[model samples]
Each structure stands twice: as structure tokens, then as C-alpha cells.
Target chain A: MSAESITLEELDATERFLLAIADDEFVTGQRFAEWVTVGPTMEEDNVLSSLAQDEMGHARLWYELIDHGRDLDTVGYNRRPSERRNSILLETEHTDFGDTIVINFLYDTAETLVLEAVAETADDAVGSRATKVLEEERYHLEHATQWLERLVSTDEGRRRVTASFERLLPRSADLFAFDAAVGTAPSTAGILSRPTDELRAAWRETVEETISSLPLEVSADALEAAVSEPVTNGRAGEHTDALTALLDSIHAEGLPADHPASGYHA
Target chain B: MKLEERIAAGQLIESGDELTDEYRELLCGIIQFTANSEFMGAFAESEWIPRAPSYQRKLALIAKNQDEIGHAQMQYQLAEDLGRDREQMLTSLLAGENGFGNAFHYPADEWIDIGLLAWMLDGAAMQLQHSLMKTSYGPYARIMKRVCREEEFHIRHGEHIVREYATGSREKQERLQAGVDRWWSRAVMFFGLSDSRSEKSERMDELGIKPKTNDELRQQYFDTYVPKLRNYGIDIPDENLYYDEETEQWEYTPPDWEEFNRIVTEGGPETQARLDRRRTAFEETAWVRDALEAYDGTTANRFANNITA
Candidate 1:
């Protein structure tokens, strides 16, 4: 339904659902942008840079849909960690290029799946937005897939990337664990029709299948261990200290009082 | 027509074979320096991406620095097409055996320095690059066209930030002033030596690689930026700086060439630090590149990968 056609409950649920997606994109983009000028090669650096900016652009699009009267920068940078809604998988510090690659794969894969769910069941406005976001996400997945193959081709690359997968994949259990955030309101309001568990299962299958092709081994047992762990999630605004540090660092320089981006922190 | 005849007729040289050895050497040097500068420049300011004052600022900073890297990629490819090796250029850059702009050799001490970098340094580069859009080499001129287009955004973004700071609180204005004081001399010498003191300008002008002499570009940079900074209530570092109405020239205290040569030939404050960062990153990621090379560069191999997501 269009904005005029949709009931208030639907609008509220839709905004809640998309806010989580936007937060994920924004945080992921911030992490990705950290790769600027430091990627393995100039070509790869260019690609990562493009990916970073694309994510920020995606975040802005989602924010625009739900910001009410706030500007993008306010909605993006001014949110406290406790208020943010993103997977804990994405909030970790990127200590290696391998970490970036693994997270890129996991994040883009989960995003594509969930966005597909949104596109399939959401109102026309959101469905079209999801469709648009997926168009850009298609390249991101391709990048992830190609890099995963090449990175795993070597012993060192495989070991390092596997280590990243072990650490990061477990955190990804929170991707579809959004029930605590909006509490099935989106699903109930029909803003999202796919059952959460079904989405989680599909995501795990795709990720496992992708890893199965490579020589590298990620402990599937560990991923499942985290998945079934009770309420270990970021969707309910429970984030790791990593997100706290990220917020502090970004706000460290301190925006000027009159600066347009200066939020409550100012 | 002969290469010289084509150049003399103001024609673009599209092919490498049409060049004399001197022309090729000069063109190669110019392109190499340009490509190296882009990479190094991006490196110098790249760390600020995550720490930018705001989300919009962060995005803008990333796009700006990212453009420098993209320009490097394009220019390196252009250099390769002109008989230079991209890998060797990068290797030399990390090895401390290459030349790039003087501005990048220094650190951006404060966030305000980033503003000055994009505002003044990029502004100065754009002055020279806008002129290079008319360069005699076809590939380089074409690259400059796209490069200048993107550079316009950097300068505009910088100007916006600088304007805000200029109109902002007392503390913000003071920081902006300090950044200008630190960067002003470097920006002045950004054009390198004046035509009379430089050996390469006349030759470059003769070959049409760089049509504008050092003084000309510097003058243009001064004309645009001097008033802008002063209007913003920031101080210019040089007291002797003035426009010569009689001679139709901008005059300023010339940068200490001895200091310029020392920093350029020896190294600047951040030269070793930034280069080490690149070297370490390059060494660490050598495996990824080596692995791809093993498969004949399957890094971007589209359909050949086994993963299906």
C-alpha cells in the first residue's frame, strides 16, 4: 500500500524494519570505508571504496524513507550505539583484509535474502526500494564470491579468511534475530511476510554451501552454536563494545555547535 | 605528419610510436609523477574516513579520497600504455624512490588540515589539471578531463566545510587559521619552482605536456584562493603576498627552496610513516595478489568462481 493507503500500524512496523536495515548498511559502510587507500591492490581498493560508498548511499535511501523530519547525517551519525539496530556481525573491528572479505560475503548474502523477503511482501514503496537496493547488492555479492574463491586458493589466504569466517560467522546469527527489536510487528503487519526462522535457515544454507566449495573450513558447529544461543543478538540494541568504540571514535572530534550534523551530542 | 609537426600544429599525439625519445621521457615522467601523487595523496588523507566530523563528511571524504585512488588506477594504466610499468611505479613509491606532490609528504595534523587539503591543495592541483585538459598527449588529456571533473567536487566540499568553520565559533576559526598557517607555504610551493628557476618548464611547454608554467598556475591558484581565504577571515601566511597591479602578477614571499628541496629530496614529516603503512599493507596482502596471479589474476574472475550466492 502507498503511504495514504497503509494503516498507521503498518507504517510503524515498516519503519522499524527498515531502520534496522539502514543501521546495518550505515555501520557496514563505515567499516568498509576504513579500507580506503589500504586495500591489497589499487583495483581492489577502488572496488572496496565503491562498495563502501554504495552502502552509505543505500543507508541514506532507507533513512530517507523513515527519517520523518531529520536529515540523513543526523539519522546516521547521531544515533547512539544503544539505539542502533544492526547485526553484531557488522560492528566488529576489521583487523584484517580477510575480515573485510568474510564480512562482505556474509553481510551481502544476508542482506540480499532479507531484502528479497521485503520485496516479496512489503508495500509497493518498500518493495520497489528493496528491489533497487538489491540491484546494487547484486554486484557486492559477485565481488564477495570472486574474492572468496581467490582468497581461498592459497594456504595463507585460506587460513586467514577461515579464521575471519569462524569469528564473524557466529556473530552473523543475529542477522535474522530481529524479533526482539520490532517483536514480529513487521511480520504481523505484513510489512515482512517471511518467517524469521525460515530466512535464517536459507541464509545458513547459502553461506555453508558457498564455503563448501572452498578448501577453507569454517566450524559450522560454532555458527549453529551461536544461532541457537538464547537471545544473543544485536537486533534488540544489544551491541558489542566494538560498536561503542566506533561511536566514540566517530564522535571524538566533536562536531561544532552550529554544524548541521551536530545532533544531541553537540 | 611527423610527431613534432603534429605537436607543432597543435594536434594530439594518440600513439606512443609518434614520440621522440625526449618527448617520451618527459611524458613518461609527468604521467608517472601524476600517478604516484594520486596514490600517495590518497594515502595521506585516507585515515580520516572513519573519523570525519559527521556522516555526510565521512561519505564526502571517502568519495574524495576514493577518486584519487581511481585517478591513480587510470593514470597508471595510461602510463602502462605509454611503456611504463604499474607494478614498478608502486614498488618504487613504497621503496621511497619516487616523486609525488609535496603536500602529501606532510601530515594533516588536525581535521582542519583535511579541509585545507581538499580546499587549497586540491584547488591548486585543479588549477594545473584544468590547464592539462589541453595537454598534447591524448590519453593524459582525456584522463585529466575526468580527473578534473571529480576534483571539482572535492574543492567544493572543502569550500563548504571551510566556509562553515569560517562562520563558526571562535575555537573553530582558530583551528582553521592554524591549519592555513601550516599548509600555506606548502600550497605556495605546490606549483614547484618558477619558470626562471625550474629546468623542466620550458621543455614541458615546448612538448605540450604541461602548457602552463609554474608561475602561471601558482598565480591562478593565488588569484582564486587568496581572496577566498581572506574573505573567510583566515590569515594568509605570507606577509609579502600581494597582487602586483602594475606588472599584472601575484607576488608573495617565495617558498624557501632549500626547505622544499630538503623535504622533497630527503623526506617530509609523514613521508616515512605513510610509506611504511603502505609497505606493510602491501607486504601483508602480497599473498592475496600472489594467489590471484597463480590463477592468472582470477581476482575478478566473474563466472569462474565456485561460490554460488
Candidate 2:
């Protein structure tokens, strides 16, 4: 069988890759959406809301690429928290606007590197979906960087932004630690052009470049601390208390069991 | 022709035109009121985003909230152009000195309540805003043109749930009915005082700011929702509600006027809680705003609502 032909190992690699990226997006989208009504300004609220929708839509797009024989709702919303593979960074509760900007900046930077790998290496479906996500993700990076610049430019803003980076950056190590297969198996299967460790390194450099330009106090030592990874590998289905709580609200009980995906009316 | 004469002739009011203070003030007032309503409504409905039963429902609800917030942005921009700052408007809302659409002050206790909110209550608001698409205020009419289009989708989002539950298992039907009962009176009071008492709206109708009177809009709401709810076997909760064939009006027992006045002035069950939510959020993020202001080399924003200051 040729590389492009069907292979169990390749399919396993692909599914793992997609689930990791899609779960990251899905969880991040939910966290971003919680900012909808109460951002620092109305304009930022709208922008953050749009970004949330984009991430969720991206999640749905990636979920659609899976052949799990489950409906999109089940794939996207019904999975147990123990089954989800999102980074703990994405799952953590946003403590402040500083957390919002820092997480967005950190997450989107890593997302760009990962998506670019899929876009560069994978063919057919994965490549096309990655391409589409990368386009929407361009603006997300801009939104993050723009906010970071503004927030880091003030004394109080800089203090909070720096503190948020200190607290959240270490958790972001999970971004590249989705699966042990992540480091070499996906690229060998021709699914990603580069391995996870290489992408993780690039991710740090890109994030460093962005933060260095700003007046943020995040240090090289702290960046190296973020490199110490996989204390809780998200791909292993271990999660924080936040993910469990998020699942309870999202896949809520008391909804009619017979409710349809188009809503029960359909 | 003078502004009044042009207004009488159904001329569309545009910005930058010389106008009587009354027309301008009235225009600014309604615009501010609407902007506040959209802002408050978006905030109220957003709690359901995490709780929507399906992923599609969740996304649709978020999109609906986004539209409301977008509408608030446009409305606030128009309000700002008319003389008030958007920051002041937001500060006023948080301060609770400004009143918004009364329906949002109540709590949506269940997903069913959110369903009623979008279907029944938003359906009620669509009646008034739809007519405002033809309002004599050109800027407002244009905004309403887009607002009503989005609102139509919101009502359908609501109706989808309403129909599902109303026609579902017995327990489902009971929950739907319960939600209808809770929201019905609030939806009715959304139109405000009746024709005789609503002198302010009468002036608005004359000025073409509100092209329909409160009673007329209330009747429109009844005409649209009554039969649909009845068909779904959801009770209207107003036993006194009936169409008077001879007068061609919805003749019903009005909602408790004293309660209406109290909710309007002092606010409803969730008003303080929701406002406190906003107040806490605002205070929590003051550093973000200050940082932006400082970075932009501007003084810290002094939002100047009389009540806020």
C-alpha cells in the first residue's frame, strides 16, 4: 500500500492530530465566548465574540473531517471531559483581560505553527481544512498582538499582562504535548511537515519575538520553564477541574433527550 | 418646508439637518434607550450560550448575542453622534440610572425561559422594530432595517425551541407552558402604557420617531404570536386576552401597571444582579481601559453621565 492509500497507523495519526487541534479550538472558543457581554469595552466584546465563533466554527470544520460515525453535535459537544484533548491552558478560566490577551497571544501563536504544519504536509481534506483555518486564524493573531501591545504599554496594564504570562505560559507547554505520537509519528505518516518538538521550539521563538517587542517582563528563564512539558499530556485525556465544569454546563442535563440537532422543532 | 412640515409629509430625518430641539432630543433619547436595551439584552441572553442544548443552538445563540451587541454598537455610535459618548451611555446603564427594555430586567431561569425570550419576547420586540425600519429618522430606520432582519432570525431561533417543547413529551410541554406563563406578562408590558396614557409615544408617533403607538405595536404583537402559540397548544397566560372583533383590537387585561412602574423605576428580579455583574466586570477591567488610554497618550476616560459622575 502506498503512503496516500489507507493505513491504520496513518488514520490513527490523523485522528489524533485532528482531535488535538479541534479540541484546543473548541475549548478556547468557549473560554473566549465567556467574555461576550463584559469585555473592557463594547468593541472588544464584539471582536472577542467573533473570534469565539470563528474558533468554534473551526472546531466544527475539523470535527467534520473525522469519520467517527457520530453526529457533529455528539462529536463536538457530547464527549466526556475525560475524552477531550485540549491544552489545559485553553481550558483554564480567564482571570482578567490580561489573561484573555496573553492566552490568545500564546494560543494563536502555537495554533499558527501547528496549522501551518498540517497545511504544508497533509494532502486533500486535512490540508484544505488547515488552509481555511489558517486564514481565519490570521486575524486572531492580529487581535491578540494588538491587545498585547496596548495592555503592555501601561504601568498597571504591564503589571497585569506580565503576571498573566507568568501564570499561564507554563500551562501552555501542553500545547505541543498532545500525544507521544505527536513528536514524530504524524510527520512520518505525512500528516505534519514537521515534528511537535520542532514546532514547539518555533512556537516559543515566535512568541518571544512578539513579547520582546512589547514591554512585557516575561523572561528567557520563564520561556525555558514553558519548555518543560507534558506534566499533564492533554492527549492522554487528563484534564483540569475547569474542563469538567465546562462539560457539565455545555452537555447540560434536563434538556429533552429527544431534542434534534436542528433543534427539536425540526 | 420647515422640519415639522417635512416631518408631517413623511420626510426622512437625516443627520446634520437643522431641527427643533424637541425632535432632536426625542431622537437622541430613543436612540440611547434602544442602544441601552440592545446592550442589556445581549448581556442577559449570553448566560445561555454555555447552556444551549446543542452545539448549533449554542452557536446560534452566540450569533444572536453578537447581533444584539453589534446593534448596540451601531445604536451607541448614532447616540454618540447625537451628543452622548458611548462610554457615558455604558456607564449610565451600569449605574442603573438609564432604563432599558423592561423585559431584560427579569431573569431567564431555564433554557426554556431563553427559548421564550427569543421566540416570544424578541418576537414581540420585532413588531415594533420592524415598523421602525420605516421610521422618519433616516439613520435609525437604516439601523432598524438591519436590526429587524437579524431579529427575524432570533425569533425563529426561539420558535424552534418553543415548537419543540410545545409539541414534545408531556413534561416538555409543561416546561414550555411554564416558561410562557412566566414571560407572557413581561412581554406584554414591553409595549409600555396604553394609548391614552402613553402621551410621550403619541408625540413620537406624530414626529414619526415611533411610527406606531404602544397599543398599535401591542396589537401587532398579539396578531403575530397569539395564533402561533395557540396552535402549538401553549397557553398565552392571559385569560383576559381576546381579539375584539368589533374594535379590531386585542382587548385583554393589561399587566399589573403598578408592578410595571415599579420594575421600570426600581428594576426587576435580576436587574441588580445583572447590573452588579456588569459593574464588577467593569471594575475588574479598568486596568485594560486605563492601559489603552495611557498607551494612546490620552487622559483616563471620564465618562460623563450626570448620574455616573
Candidate 3:
């Protein structure tokens, strides 16, 4: 089959975007799954494991969407780190459920914002995929918000959460960092509502406005605009020490070269 | 009494209408006490799930911690049913206004602590829970019956690890003994003061929730475990520990109950750090909760209704 007949440019953009999103979800979700037997309480274990599994499911859906029909063993597991674009936020492993909760919520919010923006794209495949994710993103946002409020309402909880948020807040805007992989800038390519700095700003408005009641503020008043340039490129294979250590422990066994291509499934 | 007959007969006494004001106060206090303690313990124990040494152990540790949370839920539900709310339990625990379980207040330390806790502390708990399986209180006893089954697995899991270290290399043996040494005093303390002098023993015994006194239970522990320790060539931490054939019970140096009481109430070495972690996670996700609560009323609820239809 001719490539153009089977794949839309928008679909191609979506396949790329979803792989990164799915990878971020899967890695973080697997990390969180480590807490299954070890949660602070039995109730928290069930809840955490369930969420971890949900993230795996999220990854699965996106994988199928991006599944170009290569062996999973080859493309999913054996690819060099450069071909993977999952954000660094999801890669850092913190055993503390508190850290897990904080990290995951921040990512869920940023992801939801980006996905919703893409849902409005003129391309049917991109918009359709984005729409599918929008439904699940709502639940993700809700779960994160609930725990965030519970933490902030108390003095000690507020202190700990604020610290974690500060650590993560600067990194979140990096989700929209454009690479050649994301296919030239919207201005350069003349695409509608491509994920530009402007899109991130609108997302900032939506998030900051919603969380205004809480103590969180961008590091400075100008951060909403100025922080668009990422201090680190998690999507470009740059990662923190924590991410490196976590990957070493998790993928202790390297994948074979012939694994299927990594992407979301249903 | 036969276990089944005792369980059956006690089930009758469980439903009696003689709930006096003082009895209500006492029972409510116990329910709240155990519920709060379970929450604090559960929060601490969960840290072990990810760091467990092996795949099989990982699954076992997870199951044990899961059962613990389930036990907490059962206890909390009973507390709630008795008129105390989840909010009160949460407040009492997070605020440090109530008792948390003893072992959980301490960090798991090394992998050996997992085995020691399972073998000894859990064994102690099972003894108590087994008695409580026939407890006078209806709901608490019923919950114990389920919890006891899971507790058995915990005991065996603990045995498996301890035995592994005992029979393995010298390094493994050292690790095993070191774990026991670190945990031995705590295990003794876990059963509480061996004193026949304490009012707690009198109160629990009179209520029929605990059929044996703390000292008697400690003796039972020594009798059951000392010979086993000897058989495995694992030394008991307490030098003075010995079993009396005449009394058909073992005796040992008593743990510092004052310290036990202190640690369980005020924070222990790891308390502040763990609590800080819990609080941090909760605050970081407040927006998600808010969004969820908001959508629960509008988009989410509507979607649910649509799906159901």
C-alpha cells in the first residue's frame, strides 16, 4: 500500500505524540506499581495498584494507535534511548507514595492540557485520538486534584507538597518543547494550533487559575511566559540521575532486538 | 473449648442488647484504638512493597501489606459503624493524637526485619487475633477471622526468609541474626509489658476480647519459639530467656514497655519522614482532586449516566 493512502500527516503527528505520552505513562505507571505490596496502607495499595494498571492501560491504548505492526520485542524494548521521548517527569522514581502522587498529578495535568489542545486540531485522526484521551484525562486530573487538596489542607502536608511541586513545576512546561521529531514549528509549517509556547501559556492560565486557591505560584510572575524554553529536554533523552537509576533497576534484563514497535494499543 | 464451638457460642453473646454506657465507652475506645493503630502501621509497612528482595518475596510482602490495609479497612468500618467517622480516625492518626501500631513506627531497616516481624511480631498479633476471633464484640471478631487467615501466610512468609538466611552462607546467617537482634527487643515490647500489674490486661481480659494476659502470652511465645530457635542454631537475643517445664511456659527478660508506649505515641525514628512523604503527595495532587470532584458533578456524572443508559 502507498504510504499517503494509508496514513494522514495528522495521524503521523498523533502517532509520534502518543508514543511519547504512552511511554511517559507506562514507565511512571510501572514505577508506581512497585508500591503495590508496599503502600502505606492496604487501602492505598489497592488504589495505587489500580491506578498503576490504569496507566498501563493508557499506554496500551496509545501503543495500538502507534503500532506500525513490527514485533513488540524489537521496537518496544530494544530501541536505543534516543528514539524514546517520554518526558522526564514520569521517569524519575521516588518510592515515597507522596512523591509518586505529586509527580503523577503534575504530569497528568500537563498531559491533559496538551491532549485537549490537540483534540481541536483540524486533522480528523489527530482530533479523534485526542478526543479519546480527553475522556480518560478527566479522571486522571480528578484523582490528582483530590490527593493534592488533602495534602495542602494540613500544615505538614502543605510543606511537603509545596516542596515537591516546586521541584516539578519548572519542568512541566517542557512538555511542548519542539524537536525535529514534532515536525517543524507551527509558524514555520503553518499548521493550526500546533503545540507551541502559546498553547502552553493557555494551559498555564487554566491550571494556575484552577489552583489559585492553593499556595502554589510559578517561581516568578514572568515564569508563565519565560519558562517555555525547557531547562532540560526530557523528550530528547536527557534525564536526571534518578531516572537513570530507575531504568537500570527496572530493565535489568535488556530487551531483544526483534521486539514489536512501541506504541499505544486499545 | 473447641475452636468452632467457642466461635459459635461467642457469636450468640456478640448480639446481646446489654450495651451499657460504660461498655459502649470501653468498646468504642478499643475499636478506635485498633483502627487508628492499623492506619499508622499500614502507612509505614507499605514502604517495604517495592524494596522486597525477591520476586516471590515481593508478591508475599505485597499480599501481607495488602491484608494489613484490608484489616485496617475492616477495623475502620467497625469504628465507623460504632459511630466514629473516618475523619476522626484520620485526624487522630495524622495529628499524632492516638496510638499507632508499634512495629510500623520503626522502619523495616533491612530485609531481615521483614522476616523477624512476620515470624515474631505477626506471630504475637495472630495469637491475639486468634483469641479475638472469638472476641465478645461481633464485628471486630468477624474481621479477625478473615485477618487471621491472611496472618497465617505472613507467618509462613517470615519463616521462609528467616530459614533461608539461617541455612545460607555465613553472611546470610549474620544478616539473619542481626535482624533478629535488632528486632528481638521490639518483638518482646510489641506484646506489651509482661506485668500482671497492668490495668490493660485486666480490662481486656474482663471484656473477654483477650483470653490471656500479656505475660501469659509472652510465655506462650517463648515456649513456641525457643525450641524452634535452638533447632535452627539461631541464638535468641535474650541471654536470660528460658522455658520452665513445670509451668509449661517460657520466660525471658521483659521489654521496656515505657519505651514501647512512648514510641507508639510520639513519633519514632522514621515517623516524621514517612508522614512528611504522605503529606507531600496529598498536597501535590490537590488540583487533580478538585478537578475530579468538580467533574464528578458535571461531565463525569453525565458520562456515567450515558454509559449506563
Flag the better candidate by TM-score, 2 or 3.
2
Candidate 1: tens digits of C-alpha lDDT, residues A1-266 = 00121122443666877888998999999898888898877778777888889999999889889877666666777777777889898899988888988999899988998898889897777888899999999999998888888788678888998898888877887888767667675566686668778877888788888888889777867668545743557788888999988877676554445554444342
Q: Model 1, residue A257: displacement in angstroms?
A: 4.6
Each prediction's interface RMSD? Answer: 4.5, 6.4, 10.4
What residue pairs are clashing in model 2? none
Select the stronger candidate by lDDT from 1 and 3.
1
- Tens digits of per-residue lDDT for model 3, A178-247: 4534555643443335546666676677567645767654355334432566666766656666655554
DockQ of each: 0.43, 0.42, 0.09
Report the C-alpha lDDT of model 1 over B62-133, residue by residue, as the tens digit. 888889998988888887777777677788988988889999999886778888899999898888889999
Per-model TM-score, in order, reads 0.92, 0.93, 0.60
lDDT tens string, model 2, B1-309?
898899999888798888788888888888888888888988999988887777888889888898998899888888877777767778888899998989888988778888888888888788888888888889999999999988989989889888888878898899988888888888899988887845677778788888887888899989988999899987788788898999998889878989999998999999999999989999998887777776777763432111100
Question: lDDT tens string, model 2, A99-192?
Answer: 9888988999999998899898787788988999999888888888777877876788888988898888888877887555343466677777
DockQ-based ranking = 1, 2, 3
Alpha carbon deviation, residue B92, candidate 3 (Å): 2.0
DockQ preference between candidates 2 and 3, better one: 2
